[model samples]
Every structure is written in C-alpha cells, then in structure tokens.
Target: MHSSAVFLIEFGAIILGLGLLGRMAGRLKFSPIPLYLLAGLAFGEGGLLPLGASEEFVAIGAEIGVILLLLMLGLEYTATDLVTNLKTQYPAGLVDGALNALPGAAMALLLGWGPVAAVVLAGVTWISSSGVIAKVLGDLGRLGNRETPVVLSILVLEDLAMAVYLPIVTALLAGAGLAAGSVTLAIALGVAGLVLFVAVRYGRLISRFVSSDDPEKLLLVVLGLTLLVAGIAQQLQVSAAVGAFLVGIALSGEVAEGAHNLLSPLRDLFAAVFFVFFGLHTDPTSIPPVLLPALALAVVTAGTKIATGYWAARRNGISAKGSWRAGGTLVARGEFSIVIAGLAVSAGIEPSLGPLATAYVLILVVIGPLTARYTEPVASWVIARRRPSGPASAPEPQAAAEESGGAHDELADTVRHDR
Candidate 1:
C-alpha cells in the first residue's frame, strides 16, 4: 500500500510536470522534447530529485511511446506511397545515409568504441525526426510548398530504411554470429515483404475488419492489435517498432484515419514519457564531458541534412528558394535519434553513447527549427556578401558593344535615307 501510494504520487507529479512543460513549450513556439529531457534529467539518477516507485511504470510507457510513434508514422502513407518513395527517392536516401551517417561512425571509431558502436551511432545520426519535421512544416505553413513533397518523400524513405536497419541492429546487439544474424535479417526481410504485399493488396480488407463506429472499441482494438504484433515481432528477434508500423500500414481508408485520430493523444503522451525515460537513464554529469563532440556532430550533420534536402529538391526541379527550404526543413533530428541511442544504451554497448547522443540530440533538436526557418535566408545573405559589388567586365563589355553597334546601325540607316 505504501509503495502504491508512492507510485501514484510520483507518477502523478511526473505527468503534471510534463503537461506544464508542454504548455510552456507551446507558448514559446518550440518543441517540448528538450524540456521533457531536462525534466527527466532532474528526476534521474544524478539529478536533484529521484523517484523510486514509478520508474518501472514510466519505462513501460516509454516502450509504448516508441511503438506508437512508428505506428502513427506508418499510417501517414499507404503502401503505394512507400513503394513510390523507395523507387523515386532512393538516391536522396543514399545521399542522406552517406553524408549524415559517416560522421557519427567516424566519431565513434575515433572514440575507440569499436565497429558495433560505430554502426549504432551511424543510425543515430542518419535518421531525421519525421514528427518534428512534420510539425515544423505545419507550424511554418510550408506544407503547401513545392518542396514539401520532396521532403516527405525523403522522410518516407528514411522510415522504410528504418524497417530494415532496426532488425540488423537488433541482431548485432544480441551478439549473434554471422549465420544467426543472416537468419534474423532474412526473417525480418521476409516479414517486411509479406506485410507490404498484404498491405498493398488487401489493406481495405484489414481496415474493414478493424473498423467500428464506437471510438472506444476502435481505440482498444487498434492498440491491442499493435501491442500483440509488436510483442510477437520482438519474440521473433525483429523490431517491435517495425511490427507496429507494419500493422499500421495494413490498415487504410477511414480505418487508418480514424485510428490515427484516436491514437494521437496516446502517442503524444507516451512519446513524451519515452523522451523523459531516455533522460532518466542518462546522468546529467555525463553530458558535459561529451558536449563538445555532440556539438561537433550536430553541426556537421545539420549541414549534411541541409545538403540532402537541397539535392533532393533540386533533382525534382524545384526552384532554388524551394530547394533551400527543403534542405533547411530536414536539418532537425529528434525522436529517431534518441530511439536509436536508447536501444544501444539499453543493450549496454557503450556507456558513453547515451550521454553523447542525448547531448547531440538536444543541440540539434533546438537548432533544427531555427535552421529550418533561417537556412535559406542565411545562405542568401552570405552569398550576397561574397558576390562582386558591380557587374562583371565581360557582361559590361558585351552590353557596351551592343549599344554602340545599335547606334552605328541607326546612323547608317539615317544616312541611307537622306541619300
């Protein structure tokens, strides 16, 4: 009874605190993620106040948060959208992987954390936060922009890549041998293929089966199904997040829209909890030691992400202004970075990885919005400053020659008329 009372008090306080923090962020016109992380730090191991009883409950909520995040992300598009993005935007995806992922891998190796840590860090740096990007797009009223499709295509491809990447990382973290890892990879691919096939061919059927007029029933059914699939996928050594995402992809039409609306509140709640949980496990003191490296990585990756968006948009023949907007929009890395690092930390791969990732994400998430808003104008300003003050000599000479020739021709025509 005493423990139950403690849990209630602690959990209640945490939720209330999160709510307040979220409201503060909303008023400040920024993401509440960093604030949530700070709160977790304060309540975590080395911070001002540590909670004893509600930690386990918070942990469970955090897992659910990740699941819901991937699931809702999946619902944002149909199977056709995914396939189209994979085919059309693959080059951008590859560029994104190479440009952004390499720095994290290099940093890990330099830190002597081994190849496994390098791979883990690569994922942490590779993915941009779709949730954050989408929110920013809406907030900035850029959803209707020409470059928006290019941005969405790139995000879709990244999410698809995650479906494949997560399984490989899972196998690696479990210390599986080559054969075991290959088997796990094959299974994951097979499951993903099967889900895609089903979603593409019979998504409406699946949705009809799950659909209901009652919101409560719909919510319970969707949530329960997602959890069941996620648990089974985890049991099979696949990513639970992937499983939830696949479940989401298998529903379409009104069912997908309805489920999305019903689950959004839950997703937000659990996602906040997940961020806090990540911070809870990280010691505040550890962040400072790794702050410099984190800052460096954030700066490097932010530029790469901008390049990625610009290249993708330019390839699509968007205007330079649109392309710049596209690049800036993709600069922020948020939830997925934390998710990847959280996996590594939970597996105990590297002790310092968590703190470094936390600090890196904090820097980027805050900088992301600012860059998205200013990258284009800032680039334009710099270019304008570097440009020559006057017209080029070549153009000036050509203009003068044309003017003189026109004058001579007019005089000749006048003389000919007089004669």
Candidate 2:
C-alpha cells in the first residue's frame, strides 16, 4: 500500500479499536483514557503496527485537547464558585499536585534526565481529571453528597492552575525563556484588563444580549470575542487556555449555558480525536529499559497525590473519610501531563524520560477513576460508622440550611438539566 493509504488504514483501525475499547471500559467501570493509551501502546511503535509517524502530531493534538478541555471546564465555573469554595481546594490541590509530581521529577533527574523534563513531568502529574470524577460521581448518584463539592472544587482549582501555568511551562520547555518579571507584569495587566473590560463594559451589555431574541447570534459574538482574546493572550506569551478560561469566567453568570451548549459537542469530538491520535502515535517500543524506575515514579504519583489531597481535605475540616475520597479522586492525571511530557521531549529532553513519565501518567489515569467511583460509598460508610446520626430535622430547618442545602438544590437542578 502507498504510505498515505497505509496511514489511513491504520488510523481507521485505531478508531475502531478505540470504540470497542471504550465500550469495554464502560462495562468495566473505568475511565477510557487509560484504556485508550494502553490500546495505543499495544498497536503503536513497539507492538504490532508501527506507523512510524512523528510524536509531534500526537503532542499537538494533545495540547489542543487540553486547551479545549479547559475551555469547556471554564464554562462551568463562576467567580462566586471560586470565592465560595476554592479556599480549601486551591492550596490543597497545589500542595498535593506538587507533592505527587515532584518526586517523579526527582526520580527522572536522579536517573539522569534533564531539568526541563523533570519540571514538565512534575506539572503533568499535578492535575486531576475532573471529567472522570464527575462522571463517576453522577453515575453513583453521589453528586449531591457531602464530598461532591469538595471534589469539584479541587478539580476547578487544578484546571485554573493549568490555565495559568501551562503557557509558562510550555514557553520554558520550548526555550522561549520567559522572564519571570515579564510574566508577572503580563498577568497583572491581563487580570486588570479583563476586569475593566468585563465589569465596566460587557457586563450590562451581555445581559441585554442574553435577553435578546438572537441568542444564537449572541453566542457567536461571545465565541468570537473569546477566540480574539485567546489570540491576544497567545501573542503575549500567555497560555491561550488562560485567556479562554477568563472569558468563560466573565460570562459565567451571563452566558454559561449557551456557551457550554455551543462548545461541548465540539470539545468532545476534538477531544476524542486527540486521545485516539495520541494513542496512535505513541511507540511502545520506544519506551526505554527503565521499567523499574518508571514503575517507581508511577507509585509516587499514586501515593503522593492521594496523600496530599487527603491531608489538604483534612486540614479544611473535612472528615477523614472525605479526605480520603478527595485524595483518591484527585489521583488521575490526564491530557495535561501528556502535553507536558511531549513538550519536554521536544525541547532536547531525552525521549526515555519523556516516555517514562507518559507511561506512569497512563497508569494513574486508569487507576484514578476507579478510586473515584467508589469514594462516595466508601466515605459515607466510613463517616457513618464513626459518627452517630443526628435526629431527623424538620423540613423547615433542613430547607433553611446554608450552602449545603443550596448545593443539594443546585445538584438536583444539574441532574434535571442533564436528563
């Protein structure tokens, strides 16, 4: 077959394999990301069908996946959500994510990998895949439960961190050598500009447009603006994800439902291709003879992410059981880590370390979702066994309860909306 025909044939086969594997993953109660990667490994370079394509294509697709993923994530967030919930999640997510990721970096360095590879790998391990967690929680009817918001909060914070830090990390890895001073100044300016533009100019105007009959047109306008700002952010050497995130934040109260509706299908399709292609490109044969060390790094990823998130939740006054759930839920690393590893490999970093880190990330992505799936029952069982139940409350008092009740109501609304 001609090379082009060969490429098309392999690509079609990979997609078919992914669809079958996705069905199996659903039946097995696991996130499809890990299964997808595993399939990729089996069929990619070292396994059966080595297309021998450059890794850069997978890397690029993965990067776009993260960007669009964050963009969709940003649509769900609001300033109110952050101010109300992130106090506990942000610091905890940072500490836990860092703890989980750093050791992996150290392991890489100790094994003679370069510093950029270490940092890139570190950042990749720092994030939790909220999509996986939320799906698990919803399927189990645990979305309104006690630990749900905490998990959501941490995922939100992690996504925010990715938006802010991804560009800086990418820049450094690409050897653009961003100055700390310039980055700080740019962030300040960006925040200020966003505030002035939104609060002063667009806030009232957006309300009118939202109330207008031409909601579709309004969505197009908002999307155009979002992409424009994202372009500007890219021009400023900031992550386009950051810009898109802020735009979503600005429209949080005003145009969220519309924005999400418009963007979600696109996000899903692109994201699917991104992962499928990502798997298609990974050459399992290229993985070095460092399985022992890679496995060690994978253990660190699993242990520290779980422990740190657990500790953070405990410090936030969560029940010990809730903390455990939070930690377990946060353990999965997804597209961000893959993107980071690719960046490292591109920047003169060794392929051995990059693929090693990628390998570990795939393992965690597989395990994290399974842990999150049972968190609620496990937490409720643990907490309920430890503490006696209080007397049943009157409807009046229960209804009058603070944010907890509101959260339940919102969750109910979310379910209704989803259905």
Q: What C-alpha lDDT values do all the predictions have?
A: 0.86, 0.63
Query: For residues 186-232, could you state the per-residue lDDT of candidate 1 as single tens digits?
Result: 99899999999999998888999999999999999999999999999
Model 2: per-residue Cα lDDT at residue 379: 63
lDDT of 1 at 119: 94
The candidate 1 region of ten consecutive residues with least summed lDDT is 410-419
Per-model TM-score, in order, reads 0.92, 0.77
- Model 1 misplacement above 4 A: 390-419
Best by TM-score: 1
Cα lDDT, model 1, residue 10: 98
